[model samples]
Target: MELTADQDDELRALTTSSEVSAAVGTRARIVLWHAEGRMKKDIAVLAGVSRPTVDLWLGRYAADGAAGLFATKPGGPREQVSADVRSHVLALTRVTPPAETGLSHWSTRTMADYVTRTTGTPISHHWVANLWREHGLKPQKQGTFKLSKDPAFADKVADIVGLYLDPPGSAVVLSLDEKTQIQALDRTQPLLPIEFDRSEQRTHDYVRHGTTNLFAALNVGTGEVVGDCVPSRNGPAFLAFLKKAVAPHAGREIHVVLDNLSTHTTPDVKAWLAANPNVHFHFTPTGSSWLNQIETWFGIITRQAIRRGTFASVQVLVRTIRAYITSWNTDPRPFQWTATADEILAKVRLTQLNIKKLVANNTK
Candidate 1:
């Protein structure tokens, strides 16, 4: 079917509305009904619209086939902040605190004021926002994390990573790390289904089910995870976890890369170390905890498996974690480290040389 100029305009006008809107869907359904040769009342009943509305749409469609459902009102090209002016504003943003603009972090209103002050152009707040976005700029806060410092840390890291990188025959390569004192919280309400006229579900307050220290080791070759929940996450606990991760396999060297916590280098750990020539530990470069493979898996668990979770108790949380591990292990896939041996070695040398330079400076 085809439409007249008036019908084309009517259909084209719908471009302003979203595709999922009832107005658009209604037009589609009506056109489909007309194509099927259904009467106006029957189409109205099926589409949940009034008979008159159906007739109006059908009349429009009869006059103008597919083109009638849309309107072609033109919009003018958007006025934008000039390239020079935007760059100037961005430079100002870096030098001047947002307080001078009467707002924080270069908001649209603030940017508008800044542009006006510098160029005397009465830029609208909305235009200011679009211009900032156009120039690839937005307000964002910086994140923070703890740093590590351990002498001889990098030299031994390779030997630790070797278990995963190139393990001894018939040996399991486990990447071990501890996530400490994880709080088990339960939401008060079940998640509400998304629907019309339904009450939103919410948690009035959270129930603390107690905290558990997660001592986890990832078998990179096998892609299986061995995890334990303990009451504490101290150095002693770490040694115990090492014992558990290493105990199952005999006569094979288990290379593990981890952070240098005080507990990890304790006397008990030293004694354990003496006993197990089969187990080796590697430490990541200071401020580079992100290099640990076990930490990568931990990120997956936090985002995909544990974020916004509600457990009934510590036991329930443990059970859920176990179930998740079981499900994951069913399709155990090995993870390959992409960073080259040379990159690792270079950073190690740089860190060691920097330390030596510091020591020489102190002596002088």
Candidate 2:
């Protein structure tokens, strides 16, 4: 293949320019490579396309020049959905389905059926789905949010986040929490072992063998955990766990990040804090226990060990938990905190503003 200087420059520009579509760029590269005396098979390998496709594009280019390399929209013209019909679909999608329909939310099929019957448009569910996608509407999905009611939410958040991002020198920072009522369950029948093509299975029913509480303290600096399985979750149990957790770090400042639980602030806990002058508590904002790092560890343990375990007794469950903790400490990796307090507060402020706007619109 041979090209004029003008054709070569145009082809090079098409391949290099960011404004050109990827398909166009690829097509241009194929032609340029062919002009450079590369084999059709080599071009096929480099361009990630079949030799047949390379031949087709080369044929198009030879027939129509640079204009032929561009792709024309595929398929016939779409059925024209009128502006009124589009507006109607969008408006209904923004609201809950009518009470008479007995639907809490709208699905593509239900919305399509309703629109077809009401407007006599005979719209297909697929069409309704495509229209919804074009408008960025997803009535099937939902999310959850909660605004903290604590008066000192900002200060508490700043305190905890500061500890995470920059801990005090020579001080121990621990995220402490209790996983309460961990039941020891055993399946009534023996678990069916997994086969080559099947998953392991167990009976849906189980025998409950009592419950225990776990108090875990996650070391922020090293990702190590100090844990205890106690019979109950009370101020006494928490105090005992705290003493055990901080025993190794005696004579150094200890910062414990915990939630605002009643037991956490009980008289016994207050007395223990008063007695231990080096120990300090940094409570997360009310109703924001998710801020505690130990909660993440709890989730990990539940998913990995507790949820599927067939424990014959609470003792077995506790031992399993202890073994898991020991294994974790053998190679502990700290969860890195990236978001700054300012970034978090800014997002919360934006959410609050949006809520206010929604409330005002609803009132109107």
Candidate 3:
């Protein structure tokens, strides 16, 4: 192997630079030596590094060329926990109630305890912190899950979400979902924002006024969201909300994308759908409400308007939410959702294969 001018420059930069460490220099030297047709052990001795390091770097250079050498993470030592243990911890963490480890919901302390007691291998709390940070795992103050018993879950979801991805020739695509709990509370102190003289924060404890439900219908293509606040968001109320959300564009064939909640497909809703053949309802799969565009809008509302605000009552919350919606619509843009159905199905299929392989390996 003969060194190209680019390879020579990179090798010279590695040894003479202030940016990278000696280990990186070792890698660079291996690159230079291997490029000059030198053997791995000979390169190791000349570079004053181990033979395997030279061998590994040479192999990497052969596989990916110069970019692979400097791509190593320049950080502290990685965790000592095995991949199996890390997978086990994540699997357990995803489970709800989390009472097996004796906490209402998972906390860092709870996770640390489970790692120590269940595996019979005591791990440091600092290691627990490092693990969560490394994995982008954290405990939210409030997180919830929905369990649906809808029979027509998958097909309905595919149809509804499909409209957003691949819409009809000339029709509006609306992804609708009900966000049931909108708490109205006047906090002990006002929420503090991070700006100059904006850092004065609020107390978590607040005066409970009431709660409201926001029935949202978002037009994916048009970036239009229309919603209403109601005291409840069950079957009857949802039907009424639907009547309002759909009535504006009556007598036209419009696609309504909704989640697989039992109340969403009640006999009343079925009768309504029958009455309005032009208004078709598409449902997202169970535990797949994230597929809805209105869900994306809801997340923005949570972060921007609701989570930190202190509303005096349900009416106040409604007013604030509506105002925020109006403000958002002023410069509305349709969200660009890029995940393909193939990618999702591939992930599910891969997980299934991994589970099967794990079982087979365990049995063996």
Highest lDDT against the true fold, candidate:
2
> How high a TM-score does candidate 3 get?
0.64
Candidate 2 per-residue lDDT, tens place, 1-364, comes to 7664446656766766666686777798789778766799988877789999999999977755565676655786676777767767776676556568876566566788888877777786667766766776655443123458899999999999999999999899999999999999995532222211113211135899999999999999899999999998988888889889999899999999999788889899899899999999999998777678998888778767786578999999999999999999999988898889998788678766655554454355
Candidate 2 regions off by >4 Å? 1-144, 188-203
Query: Each prediction's TM-score against the native?
Result: 0.52, 0.60, 0.64
lDDT of each residue in 1-364, candidate 1, tens digit only: 3322233333333423343354654575566545445677877766678888887777755543433443324686676666655555555433323344444244444556666865665676556545544555443211112223555545555555555566678766677788886778886532221221223222124889898878888887877887888888787788878888877777776777677778789999988888878777776666656667788777667645564468878887777777877787899766887665567667556545544553454355
Error of 2 at 258 (Å): 0.5
Worst 10 residues of 1 by lDDT: 195-204
Query: Cα miss at 242, model 2 (Å)?
Result: 0.8
Error of 3 at 320 (Å): 0.9
lDDT of prediction 1: 0.61
Candidate 3: segments with Cα more than 4 A from true spot: 1-79, 87-108, 132-157, 190-204, 352-364
Which tens-of-lDDT digit does each residue in 258-338 have in candidate 3? Answer: 775888889998998898888887767776676778887888787667865779878889999999888888988898877
The models' CA-based lDDT, in order, is: 0.61, 0.79, 0.66
Question: Model 2: which residue pairs collide?
Answer: none
By TM-score, highest first, what's the ranking?
3, 2, 1
- Candidate number achieving the greatest TM-score relative to the actual structure: 3
1 against 2, candidate with superior lDDT: 2
Q: Judged by TM-score relative to the true structure, which candidate is superior, 1 or 2?
A: 2
